[model samples]
Target: MSASVPRLLVVGGNGFLGSAICRLAVGKGWDVSSMSSSGKPYATPAGHTPAWAPRVKWHAASAFSPDSYSTLIGESTAVVHTLGILLEDVGYKQSVKSGDVFGLVKSFASSLSGGDGNPLKSEEERKRGYEGMNKDSALTVLDTLISTTPPTSTQTRPFVYISAADAFRPVVPRRYIETKRQAEIEIMRKCDEHPEAGVRPTFIRPGLMYHPHIRPLTTLPAFLVDLSAKLSTASGLPNPFASKSPLHGALESLRTYPLHVDHVAAAVLKCIEEGRGGVVEVPEMRDWAGLGSKKKAEVGLQGQ
Candidate 1:
């Protein structure tokens, strides 16, 4: 808890998660700046920029260009990396079809196989092809952050990475999990390298998130869960509703579900305020859950 207003630089601030973080930070009186490829004011669905947008500065930068974001990182008291891609764009696909894929694959194989290529080039292609883009981007960002940031000041500055809960599980694809795992290693290494910098690196892995303002089509998990429940009930099978975890079930029950966008915002603020910097899984807002529990407890207390 620094006495002065903390400055936060959020990467990919125009994105869903990033924008939510920005809104929450501004509410908490933090000086927020957002960097995006477009470099334009972030507009909400209501056709207007949020009030916080006026107070926060915006930077146009590309993750591929380390120099673009280096200065911003230098000035900020904290940095939150909210950037991730589930699929490659057309341009990226075209580049991979060119010679870059082979070059990258060769380099990756070299690091693992001592330049022998004994496992065979064809084998490497089969194993690493699906993961090249994600792995490369994650590694590039990690390297840029570690190399460009001032080693001395890092300890005092916290780096929070928003990850998915599935990232910790073995069931998740290597293509997805490997990228996050590598980023974790990079953060840990940076922290170890600059103990004096006082930079604390932390990760927050939230399960599927649902906001009413967000488009329904954009939320695949919620849609799927609801669809599955309906189809199962129509077939006259045992109601499969309660079998799912509370998080997923709550999302499926959109109409009655109580999770609000503000609650998620509050959770992010709580993490930063407490300075509990580490991997926090399922960081749902306890306040909302507590209110419900309090009502039930009150009934029991009165009866007793």
Candidate 2:
């Protein structure tokens, strides 16, 4: 990596994934500014208050409110948006909406129909709905980022969106896949609109992320996926693991390819440095495996 660090702004920086990216960028000597809603207290994962926090200029803004994010984008070389929702709960609603009425309605309907409420058989249908809601969020943020900060002639400011790879496949739930795809579309549109500004939008899809400290219960899904894949391979059935019962199965191909959060952050940094703008799908476990193997081989060669 080059020592010439760029100024970067990370939206939702105090959150789990956002914080990871912030730490990596700071380590790389990049001038990083992290923004979160006002009164939203933030602490580093290590339990230490960020030294830069006092000087880094934290902004109080909501992802849904472009006006709130306007001032934060000034003179930034790159912006990363990592806002998302997993399940519809109270906290999730606060992050994405004011209430979970819509989510509750869908969940109740799905339960009544025994998971067959949606007539759309394909995963695309489900994804469409998911994207419908999330696109608004992406657009709102993009609109502010672009309008407030115009890039200089020499600067090619890139916008990075943290998405999921499920959109590429038909196996994942339509809601999850569709929302990510929609967000990607909005990102592309923003990039297209500001070609002169050199605003390049990149999408990063990470599968089944789990940190070393991630709770055991959180890994249950992945464990079941590994088991199913093994069983399917042994059963001599083509895709014996065809079912989407395990979240890990969707990302099993990446088991040996695990990528740490830091690695993903580094990749984002690389993209900014090289001005390489495109979709980068990173499966946590699988990317890490590949990296580890490569390192081991390099070490062995050095021993020789």
Instruction: Indicate which candidate wins on lDDT.
Output: 2
Q: What's the lDDT for all of these models?
A: 0.57, 0.60
TM-score of 1: 0.63
Task: Show pairs that collide, candidate 1.
Answer: 152-197, 154-197, 154-198, 154-199, 155-197, 155-198, 155-199, 156-198, 156-199
- TM-score per model over all chains: 0.63, 0.67
Task: Identify the runs in model 1 with alpha carbons over 4 angstroms from their true place.
Answer: 89-155, 167-174, 218-220, 223-264, 283-304
Which candidate leads in TM-score? 2
lDDT of 2 at 159: 85
Q: Candidate 2 residues 143-178, lDDT tens each?
A: 776676465566667888887755223233445655
Kindly report which residue stretches of model 2 are placed more than 4 angstroms away from their true locations once superposed: 1-4, 39-41, 44-56, 91-133, 167-173, 214-258, 283-304
